[model samples]
Target chain A: MLHTVNKSPFERNSLDACLGLAKAGSAILLIEDGVVGAIKGTTIESKLTETMQSSKIYVLGPDLAARGLSEDKLVDGIQVVDYGGFVDLAAENTAVQSWL
Target chain B: MSEGTIKKFMYVNRKPPYGTVYALESLEVVLIGAAFDQDVSLAFIGDGVYQITKGQSTSDIGMKNFSPTYNALGDYDITKLYVEQESLTERGLSVDDLMDIVYEDEDDDWAEKPSIRVVSRAELADVIAGQDILLNF
Candidate 1:
């Protein structure tokens, strides 16, 4: 399954809930305001890094760019997927879960 | 429309009404998407359950009460509105707290049918997994 989180971690617990509930081997794609969670130095950075052990983490490239976040600033191991990549991820996974 | 061409689109709403513009903007997108004649469904999770709650009076807040607009969804041929059961329970709310939103089933001689389906968190996950497109708010 593919899980998508579109809310800021600082604002809502959507990212936490998703990280907690998502099974291992699932793909997580962050988009919209949710890209803030992808930053390297934030408080949630450690949790993201820990979760990356089991789940594949991804942040939408356009959403990060829109928020003025460059690829270099993202947490290590977090892959940046573009719009086409987003569609591919959706198609590849059996389901797309959105944490709004 | 060909059955194969029509895709499953689910609009996920997890924000509170009046606090932000997300709930309203999501509703507008749902309405606009209805014109495309695709299989569209709406899921209200977490704080989003407040959006369809009954007796919403925004007179003091000075914001337009758009909760009633959900009732009009049936008229647009978009009636699948799923509310997460666990979200309501966590918020100390029940099915009765929600507004009465019903749609007329054309196949059944226009009989009135309930639109708001209170589903479990697990059930809601399956619903989410079934969608081809997801719009989060």
Candidate 2:
């Protein structure tokens, strides 16, 4: 499994690089500005839903609500996680990728 | 620091919630870290401060702004959120103006909400050292 982390407003290079390597079963964590991706009706979300449909997406707790966003904001897919859970996600996935 | 016990991963959050794709992409990277089970932590500083702003409607951008997913973090377990005190003041903002997520309040409100810790650049280095991995987005 691939592990990904993002914390920017929305950098194409950040998501593209990670998504390119994703192989169906992967985890993506949203941090800081990265968690803002959890919001619905954003190009990033649609692209993720379209291309990275098979991957398991997660957003940092503080990052998500910090921006006043919830899991419901995302499409019908994409999973959300917290900081503690982020630690676990990093520990579980085999290969880790950090997209800036 | 044990053998494969603590896989520290530090992510840098430095951007606004809109006008760019860095923020969204960063989230995907963090989740990927969790899938790999790397103890992940994200530090927000600089322009990234606007990430926690409330009420985002990205419909105009022809996409869904998934900011609300931050609340679902409890599920994927990507916790560790830090903010630089300097950044807030430099950007002319306070914790109150930020989103309603867990934070270490500088004022110490001690509410049931999540705790957001405020720190300096030097302290940030200390936290970074504790991590086995660092990912700057």
Candidate 3:
């Protein structure tokens, strides 16, 4: 399953909930305000790093840029993808789970 | 728009109505998605259970009452509405407090069938596991 989280970790627990339920090898994409969780040194950074060990982590590049965050501010090992990549990821996964 | 393959699509609504437009916007997607003819289901969890509660009056809040839109979902052939039992209980709501959502079954002489299915959280999780796509809002 591909888990897509669009809420900020600071605002809601959607990312935490997704991380808890997502099986190993499942892909996680952060979009919209969810890009906040991908920023390095944020409160969720450590938890995200731990999650990355078991699941592939991605942050929407357009969303990050829209929030004035650069790829350099993202944690190591988290890939940045555009809308096309988002579509491709959804197609590649058997299911898309939107964590809200 | 793909043909010959029908994937299970589940829309997970976890937000309450009129908070930030997530609930209303999600409903619009569900309405439009009915044309795809895929197996679609709606799961109401957390605050989302409030979306279907009876006697919603947005007049005081000055927002258009979209709660009735859920009643129209049956007409669009989007009838599988799942309400998480725990969510309703936590909010002190019962099935009787929800709108009567029903659809006409063409296979059975167009008899009216209730569309809402109240299920435990565990059962809902099982339903989620079986889905091919989950749209969260």
Candidate 4:
């Protein structure tokens, strides 16, 4: 399954909930306010890195741009996906669960 | 407008009702967009599932209680509504908790067809992938 998290991990537990339920090999995409979690050296970075050991992690490139976060600031191993990439991820995964 | 172009438009609703304007705004956009003669579908993910729940009485909240407006979607030729099964499960809701919105199918002797499809996350993902445009709320 593909899990999309659109809430800030600091303000809401939606991202944590998504990370908990997302199974191994699932793809997780961070978009909108959730992009904040993609930053490196943050409290959630370790958790994201840990999850990366099993599943793929992606952040919407445009959302990062909108938030003035450069690709270099994202945690290592996390791929950046454009809107089209977002569509591709949805197509590649079996299912998608959005964490609001 | 292209002479004969009809795109697949999907409205992704992920917010709860009343708390914010996203749900209502998405619905209004869907209704307005229906006039374009395109294949339009709606997906209720996360708290979006709450927007279509039945027996929503906003009398005390001083809200419009626009849940009933979902029924009008069928009349507007907007019938495909995908409700994420996991979102509802986490929220302790079932299909029974949602309004029974239906539309008359012209191809099947006007048979009544249900608009809501309770879909697994994977199934909903497939639906999302097939869309030409995804409007998020």
Q: What is the alpha-carbon RMSD of candidate 3 to the true structure?
A: 15.4
> How does residue A100 of candidate 4 score in lDDT?
91
Question: Comparing to the true complex, what docking class would candidate 4 get?
Answer: incorrect
Considering every candidate listed, which one attains the maximal DockQ?
A: 2
**lDDT tens per residue, model 4, B7-77:** 99999998766656788899899988988888999999876776787766554335677888899898889
Q: What would the per-residue lDDT of candidate 1 be over residues B18-111, giving only the tens digit for each residue?
A: 6568989999999988988998999999768767877766553356778888999999898899999877665445788788999999899999
* Tens-digit lDDT string for candidate 3 (B21-132): 8989999999999999999999998767757876665543356778878888878888899999887665445687678888888788989999999999999999999999
Can you list each candidate's DockQ? 0.02, 0.09, 0.02, 0.02
- Candidate 2 per-residue lDDT over residues B1-137, each given as its tens digit: 22467677788888776546787788877776567665777788876766655665555334566677665553455556788877766544567656566533334463344635678988987997788777766
- Candidate that would win on TM-score: 4
**lDDT values of the candidates?**
0.83, 0.65, 0.82, 0.82
**Segments of candidate 3 deviating more than 4 angstroms:** A1-100
DockQ (0 to 1) for model 4: 0.02
lDDT of 1 at B59: 52
| Candidate 3, A1-100: lDDT as tens digits | 9999988675589999999999999999998667757877655678888988999999887665543356776889999998899999999999999988
Writing each residue's lDDT as its tens digit, candidate 4 over A1-100 gives: 8899987675589988998999899999998667767877666778998999999999987655543356776899999998899999999888889889
Residue B125 error, candidate 4, Å:
0.8
- Whichever of 1 and 2 has more DockQ, that candidate is 2
